[model samples]
Target: MLVEVGASARLFGGLEQLRQRIEVEATAMGVECIAWAPTGTAALALVRAGVPDGFASPLPCILDKLPLETITAVASHQGTLQRLGCRTLGDVRKLPRGGLSRRFDKELLTRLDQAYGLRPEVYEWVQLPETFSARLEFQFRVEHAPALMFGARRLLLQMSSWLAARHMGVTSFTLRWWHDVMRAKTAGTGGELTVGTAEPTQSVDHLSRLLNEHLAKVELQAPAGDIELIAARTIPIQQESKSLLPDTIRQGEATWLVLERVQARIGKAEVVRPLLAEDHRPEWMQRWPGAEEPRPRSAPDPCQLPVPDWIFEEPLRLAERDHRPIYQGPLVMLLGPDRVEGGWWHRVGEGADAQQTNVQRDYWVAQSQHAGRLWIYQQRLANDETGWFLHGRYA
Candidate 1:
């Protein structure tokens, strides 16, 4: 036998409208349903599990006073006695029907008879629609971080429970960042960061943490862009193996989120991943901070030698001796006296000015004897007052 129940849940309209809407939906599904008092336990019990054997149709008695033990005895007599925990009707049938009345009440017997189809049980089922949506408009354009955070948090809490009851988790959301138009037809500029979760999670705290991390790094061009949050996806959670180390690994995500927040506070240009350039020339080979984007990760070339951690930010001037800088170092490796030549096109028109600003440079690496460290440089011809300038130290 098939049984179904529909419940009315209003999003904006009143409860009666919700109930009537549910009844219509139930009728379409071909199942009779009803809306009992929200506080009525008997109605709920029957609606949830269905009327059991020897119960009256449309059973209308409190649950505690039912003759459950006596109902079980009758089932036992029919040789269908089966223990379904302590709640089976077989136990009820075994009890003396008169004693049942004397000890408690007739509600149990009435419900049981109805459950077994001994009497007709009809209910009007109301079904609630599957979706809930809401929107809010701010009177003033909001550009502050706190304002955006507060608005998103409120929406997250509401969607969280509604999603949970459906045994689901939201996958994506949209936050519209906007402002009023300053000129004809064109709206003020705005941007959005579309984020996705590594896994499905419904916890408001979890969602908030992730979103907060991403938002922290985002810089709004306008100080007064309004914000809107919307849920875009959801899915059910089924049984799965529990994590062996939930607590330990869980904080890693939180850590990343915190870092993102810090980056937001600091200018994004300030936080960078350093990458080493290949040239042995001090300035040429030294690492640059904050490369534009994440490069594809690859293993270091085994053939390439590892470089020392410190490379000079500014080259040092060495003492001169006979036009050439006095070199005092254990010659370990002559990295480069590599030539750099360019800017002749601009020099053609600018003459001496371009020559002064864009002169060619030749770099070299000199090793020190006192400390086994590498020093970087460029060779200068003495005629132009050219001299080697130390750029980096590789130790």
Candidate 2:
């Protein structure tokens, strides 16, 4: 593959860097020979000759000494040219162009002109499709979803290159597999899973980890013989600007990335985060939502008083003694009531399962010699009934 890197060298950190990167990746893909030169034909000749870098010498100087066999077109007519006393490209160059153009095939003159950087060369560059979906067929059927990652990773690397070429990033992608022909009929044909990221990304490691986490929980019914990966969604990514000043501080991964991995490892519903609400009542002031769920894009709700170390799922009704809430012993009210009175429309459930959720309570910071600190509230129930309850505690 001949790449015209003149316009893209800077985007890849310079020519040397891009060359090294391509070589490393190509080597890993079992490509044994790669070359870099000033011209496409020269590069191809270098690759054919196993010369890694031929840019050290001048273009003319390098081509002058290269044997006639370096170019395929020239190699085929070597015998005829040698009988005419032509050995090196320089020997053929010394001959009159008019005579050579008239005596030899057009391909011979064109290739020599291309190699010497005199004539323009054309190549059919890689054309990316509107959508990307790659598949891999396994030599041995994979019985576990997790076991398909080895081949899946190869597809991911290809996707990464594709993304880079397009200057884009992926937010979500799907992995699907087909069952072997020998599998039971009841096992069905295949299955698929879509992995999502909190932010647009092209990091193969991060993507692989998330996919692995989700696949680890999958139970395969039939042996998978082929796997496919599809880029479900993509967005263009802005190129990072180079700083004029040196960077000193390193940054860490975003919080959502860590949470995303955890959510994939555990069930999405099992991983929850606290979302503060607009209500004032203790329990009604917040809700627990899964990490994948969307919530308000703001800071936690503000509170004048200090929050307790722990809040019970359900408030505990405490015994009252002499009109005061009691725990192990009589409670002492250290702070006055922080009244929270509005929750009339917070009703949940339906029909017979419906329960009263409206609350008018006088909350207090109480103390007990036996228990360190307690958050106690007095509920003003219907029919003017009053009851004491413990809401939370501080260690």
Candidate 3:
């Protein structure tokens, strides 16, 4: 992987920064050895000769530093070059190019031309695909999900490289395992599990941790013969300017990763967001399970007054006293009645009759002698029977 970074040095700030970036990415991908030089041939020769960071050295010195075996094309002529008093690439370059081309192979001249930058070098750049799907076959069957971690780790490292090459991040991915059919007890051939994140991420550690949590709960029906990872949902990630302080977006992403990991470990349904419903009934005003971002509800009109901080699941019935409700002691009505009447269509459903499906309430914010601030409502009935109930409390 000889990359010509001369033109791209400015894009990465400088040559040193670009080299560091490459080293960091290479380390993350588990690459043990890396070397660079001013030219492609020089870089390849330096790496072959176990040299590192030879880019700053003179061309003659760089060429002479490599062993004779490093140049495969000229290795056969090493004895001939030594008899001609040529001990290094510098000595060979001093020979007549026309005579060298005729006496030796054309490859020797081509190698010298490429190393000295006299000829142009070309490379085919690797491009990332639209989707990611990688599979790994194990030597032995994995009896449980936990045992697949080693293979999964290898796939994850590849995924990280893929994501880096594409400059993208994944929000969701699926891991599928094939069962050993010959020794299988399960009805199906294999099983699959999908994990999603609240935010897009390219971090290998974060994704690995989430996968570990999900695999811990998997009940394998049979030994898995192979495992495959697929990244189905991905989003383009823009590079942001660095800042000295911690970024808010990054912090939010970290929090969401933790939240999604917990959800993956337990169940997706266990995590929820509150949603405001259209119903006017206090208990039916809000529901759970909504979008990641909670939609803010419009404030009630000032004339209608404010709702309590806490609302009971079912309004508590109150004792009557002189046609008014009596809670702990005598209740004081601090606010006027805010009428809410609806639910007429509920009784019109199939197999339904016009019963008590309708509602007509006179809601009020009141102060009880012992219960503190409370939200009480008086039920307006058709049979001329009215009752008071405590609906909520305010701190």
lDDT by residue (230-325, candidate 3, tens digit) is 998999988678789977653354556667777877777787777667777775576787235546667433336678888888889999889989
Each candidate structure's TM-score, on Cα atoms with residue i matched to residue i, is: 0.43, 0.81, 0.79
Q: What 10-residue stretch in candidate 1 is worst by lDDT? A: 1-10
The global Cα lDDT (0 to 1) of model 3 is 0.81
Model 1 accuracy (lDDT, Cα) = 0.53
The stretch of ten residues in a row with the least summed lDDT in candidate 2 is 298-307
Segments in model 2 whose C-alpha atoms lie over 4 Å from true places: 6-14, 28-32, 56-100, 135-144, 178-191, 218-226, 299-305
Determine the C-alpha RMSD for candidate 1 after optimal superposition of all C-alphas.
14.9
Q: Looking at candidate 3, what is the lDDT of residue 163?
A: 86
Pick the winner on TM-score between candidates 2 and 3: 2
lDDT-sorted candidate list, best first = 2, 3, 1
Q: Tell me, by lDDT, which candidate is best.
A: 2
Task: Summarize candidate 2's per-residue lDDT along 196-298 as a digit string, tens digits.
Answer: 8877888888899999999998999999999999999999988777799987776997788888898888778888988888777777778898786788888
> How many steric overlaps does candidate 3 have?
0
Q: How close is each model in CA RMSD to the real structure? A: 14.9, 3.9, 4.4
RMSD of 2: 3.9
Residues 1-395 of candidate 1 have per-residue lDDT tens digits of: 12332232435266657656655644543445453432333444434444332134324333333433333323333332233333444455456778656654455555555554455556564443476454445667666544666666666766675676787777676666665455234435655655555345676777776677767766665654356566676677663466766644443555434444455456457767656554333344335564334544763333123345676666677766654554474344456655655433333336455443244666565666765555544545568667676655665
